[model samples]
Target: MRMMDRRTKIWILVLVVFCALCAGAFLILRGIGGDGTVAVISVDGEELDRIDLSRVKESYDIEIDTGYGRNVVHVEPGAISVTEADCPDKICVAMGRLQGSGIPIICMPHHLIIAIEGDGIDG
Candidate 1:
């Protein structure tokens, strides 16, 4: 079997270490999302509403309706959740409180989706 030269061995070790470090950084950063300027609300891949969470409370439990009926959502500090939904089963509401920012509370029956958006998004 052929053996690698000293320089080649050193280079390979460096590359492996670099790759491991990169992977570690990625995992760490993925957990620490940026406090960007906007948080969007969407449903079924369609943009429904936009909210500005800047200066917003650590947690919130609010309701939104389009003149038809009422729905409830619970927004915990840094995250939002649906407590009780007007829809049957209230599955979304029962899903428990969301503990993250950048996500949304969605109700498919009403074609409604709520996401966390920044002040930059248009009405």
Candidate 2:
């Protein structure tokens, strides 16, 4: 019984240390940034439009007619998203908005990608 209790305590201490290391690693790796608040829209691997979301004083809708299909993008003060799409899956529309610099809004069928470009290190 004494040996079993000691083994359990050792395992618990190891687990705690491992968890702490993982948490610290996550915080460090999550500090990556993009260049600014500009949204770069691309279709079929070609640059289509670049909209600066920060300078967008009024909300507007941009209708994109790609060779594959059509996608309606909505631009707000600080965000951009595909509000409507003709793709069968409609996954791009369901993505809602682009708020972070991690993943870009992708339309697989239309081969369209909307990525947020960071202006500087602070963005």
Best-fitting candidate, measured by TM-score?
A: 2
| Model 1: per-residue Cα lDDT over 49-119, one tens digit each | 44454445676656766344457765544565667767765766756644433434566676556654433
Q: What is the C-alpha RMSD of each candidate to the true structure, in Å?
A: 8.7, 5.4
Q: Which regions of candidate 2 deviate over 4 angstroms?
A: 1-31, 119-123
Q: Which pairs clash (backbone N, Cα, C closer than 3 Å) in model 2?
A: 34-118, 35-118, 35-119, 35-120, 36-117, 36-118, 36-119
**Per-residue alpha-carbon lDDT of model 2 for 1-123, expressed as tens digits?**
455688889999999999999989776544454535788899976889989888999999999999999999999998999999999999999988986564679999999999887544332
Name the 10 consecutive residues with the lowest summed lDDT in model 2.
27-36
Off by over 4 Å in 1: 1-54, 101-104, 116-123
Evaluated with lDDT, which candidate comes out highest? Answer: 2
Listed per model in order, the count of residue pairs whose N, CA or C atoms clash below 3 Å is: 10, 7
TM-score for all models, in order of appearance: 0.45, 0.70
Task: Return the TM-score for candidate 1, rounded to 2 decimals.
Answer: 0.45
RMSD of 2: 5.4
